[model samples]
Target: MSTLSLPPRLLMGPGPINCYPRVLSAMATQLVGQYDPVMTGYMNEVMALYRRVFNTSNQHTVLIDGTSRAGIEAVLVSALEPGDCVLVPVFGRFGHLLAEICERAGAKVHTIEVPWGEVFDPQQIEEAVQRVRPKLLAIVQGDTSTTMLQPLAQLGEICRRYDVIFYSDATASIGGNAFDTDTWQLDAVSIGLQKCLGGPSGSAPITLSPRYVELVRKRHHVEAGIKDSHHHGASGSRIQSNYFDIPMILDYWGEERLNHHTEAASMLFCARECAITLLDEGKDAVIARHKLAGDAMLAGIQALGLQPFGNLQHKMNNVVGVTIPHDVDGEAIRHTLLHRFNIEIGTSFGPLKGKIWRIGTMGYNARQDAVLHTLQSLETVLRQQRGPITGTPGAGVDAALAVYDENRQ
Candidate 1:
């Protein structure tokens, strides 16, 4: 059999983008025993590192050993008891995902939705919260399917007013966007490293407020295999999923070091390096970089006479959705870019499937060179296709360069 080989494609898609070199290197470091002093020390460091990443002082911050969605599930399932009410505002695909997860967790789910390209206003969410009076207000801070960012600063205060636990999945927007876990009064937040942390998708960094901790801990049950004299069960109903029991996971991560599952050491290293890299660069600097690259990509697409999907004002700083031209075959264009240029962009889901292309400037791919290369290559593919499509030669690259130039000055 031939050796495993894959093309070195430039990932400019919605996520699972290029991992930072340092993160890749970190993952290659040899593993130690799960409970080794060195491994536990790294685990502690990861907890400490993610506190800064999440911008919270909450002692419950830790890593979930799965993708972004696993983090979402762990937070929701642990927090919501059977028949508890949850309010979810849907503006994009991930919003639907939040609602579905809530339903699966046996929560009575209430939903408020807007058009796919538009986000719900704070008042609309507030009105729903006022009417539904949910036990938990769950939402997505950034939904890549529509490339829209829901404004969260106000909703936090609204949840606080109604005495509702505010939980958000910032998987798509955390590192590249402005997320303040403490200032926003968020009760629980989960994020993946792939998007803007410049790492592969496996480890999820999550934070829980003291309020959230107290709520979930009531349902805590020590695994029978690891139960001991000091362990005690809570009065609340036991959490349904064994793997997602946050309280048990917290004990494993906490000073108690009670065994949960074998820690994913390589992923732990990757998460650590991702966080260290971001902090070294500085959070604001990394955000600014994403914003600059995203702006350039936006300018490039518009200069090529492409209309962007969604409300530009509410668009996330890391990804943009371009409306597929009436005459252009979106898939064919994507095919040429992937095969010929070895560069990848994203297609949308749900309401936007085949209607818009999602181009991302995120993590390690969020750079001027990557943006320009994508624009120039896309211009080539568009021009080669036969149709009513028309754009001034080099206009896309020129426009992007102008954005960089202006930023430099």
Candidate 2:
């Protein structure tokens, strides 16, 4: 077979965005033995870095070897015993995913859902938690499916009051949004490098509070070959998946340095570099940058006479959802944008499918030029599709520029 090659294109879509250059370079560095002192040192550093990225002081912060979904499964399977009750609040696709994963883990899952493109009020979630009396409350902080970010601040308080363990999949919103794991009282949180962190999507960085760690340790089972006489099977049922057992994974990452699967060295490096870049830039500053880009993108779409989907105030800082015009073939416009302008935007799924296009300003792409270029290309594609354009030819660009100028002041 011929050598592999890739095209040059801008990814302005929901996730798997361009990686930061430094992260790519770091991933290219030489590999090391998984148990090598140098490797372990880097591992510890990664754990420390992700703690800051997650805005938590949890000692169990570490990387799961697969994608973001792996981290979610690891947390759920390790913490949940068969027949354990889990309360899920579903607003979008990812929230549904959490419930599905919990169900697979043998948890008796109960869900409360809002319409797509809408977020739950804290009261609604509290009321549901009260009714369910669940052992854990699982939710997604942001679901790119409908481009809505559920407010998590008050949910944590409600969970605490109701004596429920709180967990969130922050894969789509972590770095580019306001997420305080400690202050929010989130017991467990998982995130990916591909979103606001500006890295490729293989490694999942996860953190667990002391309470979560204690619970998972109860299910710990060492491999047979490595087990000493003192090691015992879980007091409860063993975790459903060997690969996703958090306590065993932590043993590898923890001071005991017990072996788990061989770590994905390159992805770990990339994840570490991603955290360093975000922390160096200052988390608040990076979030502000995303907000500015999101605002500009929204303003530009509005200027082009397209209505936005969802509650705008509850929209994520990293993505904007715009309605597809009635006369336009949404896929055709997206195709033209990718082929002609080499820019990629996203399409929606489920109820919103074929109805809205999702435009992202996230991670390394959260910049003025990226926002303006996307808006300009979208404007051109819409015009080509014979979609009605209410404003002047360059109105989208003008509107985006106005937002940029305002942000500068």
Candidate 3:
């Protein structure tokens, strides 16, 4: 195999936002066996850290050892019994993803779609629920596909009135937005550290209310052949994968001390550090940081004469979608930004492919320096990709700095 050498790039993309140095250092710490007391101690600490990060007292909070999608899939399969009805309100690609996962899990999925970059009002969802009356409602909180944030503050009350389980994929918003799991009455939530948590992608932090845990418990199962004090008894419905069973995972982390599978210890360290970083920053400050960065980015792009793609009021406070200029090669600009400027921004997916570029100011990168670097690199690349024109780089930076100055007073 060829040896790999990766150059440092300013990640101003939709995710994996330039990891914190402390998180990287934490991940580099010496590893221990999964069952080692020190390792399990760290694991328990990770759970506690995520609970604070999620602003929830739910006892079922834990980590899934995979990307954000893995947590999404696990929740779908574990919650939706076959033939159950699930309502998904789609405004972007990730919303469609929730429907797909629930469908594959055998739930009768019903989707209410709006144009990309738009969010469904709670009334629309309530109207749909009045018609289909789904048993569960699954949605993506902030879809990077359109850089739009779907509001859920009123959604949980609606679901509760109808006795529906409410679930959200908050991978794109967590740590960068104000989210309260208990106040929102979310039955379950799944998030990744990559987007706004300033860490590498691998572990997914998830929290579930007691109601969700109880539902998942119905479908729990035990692995067939393990011989240790860690092995546990089987439940009725036989969860499909031995690896994805949440109850067994809880048992391992709980007093039962059952060994479900080898936890990703290095990832657990990084996950813990990510949560601790958020807590240290103060969640409101973190959200405000993202808001300022996003505002600066949007202003910068607009000053360059590009139109942003999403509803101005509901955009995610970290990522923005800029419409690609007619004569410019969007991918070419992205390539130049990466190779020449050592900057990384992203292209969109599906309906937005080749039409819009997704720029992010997430996590550690959500600051003036990173935002200005992205703007400068973007300006240089856009000029190279499609002839230069006069634009006000200063205008955007000054506008953002003005906010900081005002806040200081």
Candidate 3: RMSD over Cα atoms? 2.8
lDDT of 1 at 236: 56
Clashing pairs in 1: none
Could you report the Cα RMSD, in angstroms, for every candidate shown?
Answer: 1.6, 1.5, 2.8
Q: Using Cα atoms with residue i matched to residue i, what is each candidate's TM-score against the true structure?
A: 0.97, 0.97, 0.94
Model 2 global lDDT (CA atoms, 0 to 1): 0.91
lDDT of candidate 1? Answer: 0.92
Residue range 326-368, candidate 3, lDDT tens digits: 7788888888889999998899999999999999999999998
Q: Tens-digit lDDT track for model 2 on 1-409?
A: 9898877789999988988889989989999899999999999999999999998999999999999999999999999998999999988888889999999889999999899888999989888987899999999999999999999999888988988999999999999899999999999999889999999999999999998887777664656546432333547666678899888788889999977799999999999999999999999999999999999999999999999999988999999999988988999999999998999999988889999999999999999999989999888888877798779998999999999998779
lDDT string, candidate 1, 49-85, tens digits: 9999999999999999999999999999998888999
Ranking by lDDT: 1, 2, 3
Worst 10 residues of 2 by lDDT: 225-234
